[model samples]
Structures are given as structure tokens and as C-alpha cells.
Target: MKVSFDPDVAMLLRRVAPAGVVWVLLALPSQSVYADDYPCRVALCVPSPTNPWSIAACVPALERLFDDLAHGRGWPTCEGSGVSMNYVNTPFDPCQGGLNEAGPGAWVIEGKKQPNHPTWFYTDPASYGISPSASPQQSAGGDAVANASLACVGKLMGTYRTYVGQYNRDYQEVNVAVYDQIVWQKPQSPWAIDVYQNGQFSRRVHWK
Candidate 1:
């Protein structure tokens, strides 16, 4: 979730960048040979981030990401493809009441529907169910990572929070805080990226 503005913000993002901020798409296995071996349909969406610290980058209009993840091998995220990419954004505080340097502008994501508000603020399984996800069977993480993180934060605050995305692919496991920071885009080795902003990859570097 990036705020569109003067080149300054772009330049800022270019330098600091979000963590796991895949500057480029991940490379995938050739579909002609291993199409059937991939996981569930991939879905991705880049939510509009109105400010920093907002939980909007997590989920937004996800139909497109879900589509490509499920149908287009050319754009991995679905079967034979890999993971999904999506974004959500928090609204800017006109009054500048939030804890943001440039007003309350933050990016957010919504992989799972939240509770009791409107849209992300208020969600109900009975009314707005969670997205379809692959069984945790072959997953390396995903729901599990979410559950784990929730257990820690939920217990501390004594209130349930949002679920985070945990890549469940077979290739590798990666820390996803990158979605927020946008700085981990370019990392040195020891960090064999199994997952990237676009999808999955082999040994190579790309700049988005």
C-alpha cells in the first residue's frame, strides 16, 4: 500500500521500501512440466494505503488477485502459480489526530474478514465470510502463522485482532512484515527468497 503523491513519496518508498517489498515478481516453475503440482488458486489485491500504520494493505478489492492466482499461470498465485498479492489502506486523518508523521496515513491488508464495524472495521462471517483458503494440509504456514501471532497479541491486549498472512508454500518461509516497511525489498544472501511480491522464485534478483 503506497500513497500516490509527488515523487518524494515514491523516492522515499524507493529508498526505505516496505519489508518483503518485492521489487519484482517471483519466478515460478515452468507450467508445461509442473503445472499440476502447485497449490490452491492464488489471489492478490493491492489495497490503497491512505496512510502509514493503517491496516488497509492486508485486504481490499481482492477479486483480481484471486482471479490471477486461480486462473493465470502467466501470473502466478493460483494452481501452478504461487501466492497472492493484495493491498488495503487506512484513511487519512483530516484532523491529524492519529500517531502519524504525515497525518494518519497507513497501509493495511484484510486476508480474513474482521469483526464488528463496517468493511474491515466491522465484518461478520455470517454476513461477509472469510476468503476461500487452501487446507492447512500442505501449508508451511498461512493460517497457522496467523493463529500463532494472534495468540501472542490477543492474549496481551485481551482483545482479538486481525489475522496475518503466512505463506504456506513448499519452497520456503519468509517474514511478511515487509508488507509494511517496504525496505526489505533488496536483501543479501542467507535470505533465499522462496516467496516474493509477485509469486515464487528461483535464484535471481529483480527490482520492481
Candidate 2:
């Protein structure tokens, strides 16, 4: 699937992926359309990577919680709790932010129609100050999962050592990083899709 994130989700992903601190009310009234006193959904979304680890580990657990809440999985009492979790993931596992982003990782989430969404990301490494072809990670893809944003992609850039290191040992490290922002027009062509890196547009894709 192909997708894009709202500015709010994109902003949050770029900020928190590097372990930046974000503040929110975290307490909302039991009902919507309430007063300004409504609680906020304060949270962070980052990449999960490892031998068996992932850039999306915490996502499914949170998704399950959403299901639980919607299902009323015997947790109606949990509503409006001081803490609430929100997360998103795609391509199933391995997380594009992880070391093997280009390998065989695809989150496969149902998303809006976009074309050639994955090639820019999985085809190259993220090389700074270089052209897209030179930088493998210059590519980008997004869906409902803003976790698929710049911060997580930063984890992709930091993957240099993984490829250079002997035996190519796994390298899963998320450090401070900055994003420029990726913005694009809704695709004019049915096959074309937008791509963003560092919260900004790196390029667009066309249908085969």
C-alpha cells in the first residue's frame, strides 16, 4: 500500500524518532466535542530494529490496545486513563529503519493508492549531501504509519556501519538527527506517488 501522513503526525514522527521529548495533556474527557480541558494523546513513535527485534515492535501492541478499546475487551474502565498509546507500522516487520531496510521488509498496511512507493527507499543507502542515486536512503515511503517518517528513516541513515562493519553485524542505533520536511502535491497521474525524506519531498514515483 501507499500512503501519506498528515502534517501533525509527520511533525511528531520527525521530532520523536530521535528520542526527543514531547509534552501533551494525556487526559481527555470520556466524550468528544468537550471543552479545551480535554486530554491529549501524548506519545512517541520510533523505529525498532535488531536480529529479531524491529522498528515497529511497540506498534502492534498499541494496535491491539486500540482493538481492545473498540472491542470493549473488558476494558471500558480503562477509558480516559492518564496514559494513552498511539502507534503505526507497515510492511509487516524488519522496519525500513532497521539495518536490512532494503532487504525484504515491507509493512503491507492497507493504504491509499500510490505507485512505486517502495523502490526509492529499499534501493539505496541514505547518503547525505549526495544525489538520490548516491544516497541509498534518499528514498522514502509513507502510509498511515507516520512511524514511517524522517526519524525512523534517520535510523536508516545510521545504518552505514552495518554495511561496512565486518560480518556486517547488525547495527541498531537511533541517535539525534534533523529533518528538512517532505511535501508533495497529490499525484496527478494514477500511477505516480509522492515520496519524502527528512520530512520533505525527495521525489515522486510513476506507475509501471
Maximum-TM-score candidate: 2
Error of 1 at 76 (Å): 7.3
Query: lDDT of candidate 2 vs native?
Result: 0.29
Q: What's the CA RMSD of model 1 in angstroms?
A: 20.8
lDDT of 2 by residue, 1-208 (tens): 3345545445544544334333322122233322221222212322111111122323333343345645656221122222322222332222232222322222211112124555334222233333333212222243222323222221222222213113556433322122222221221223222323344433332322
After superposition on all C-alphas, the RMSD of every candidate to the true structure, in Å, is 20.8, 19.1
lDDT of every predicted structure (CA atoms)? 0.26, 0.29
What is the Cα-based TM-score of model 2? Answer: 0.18
Q: What is the TM-score of each predicted model, taking all chains together?
A: 0.16, 0.18
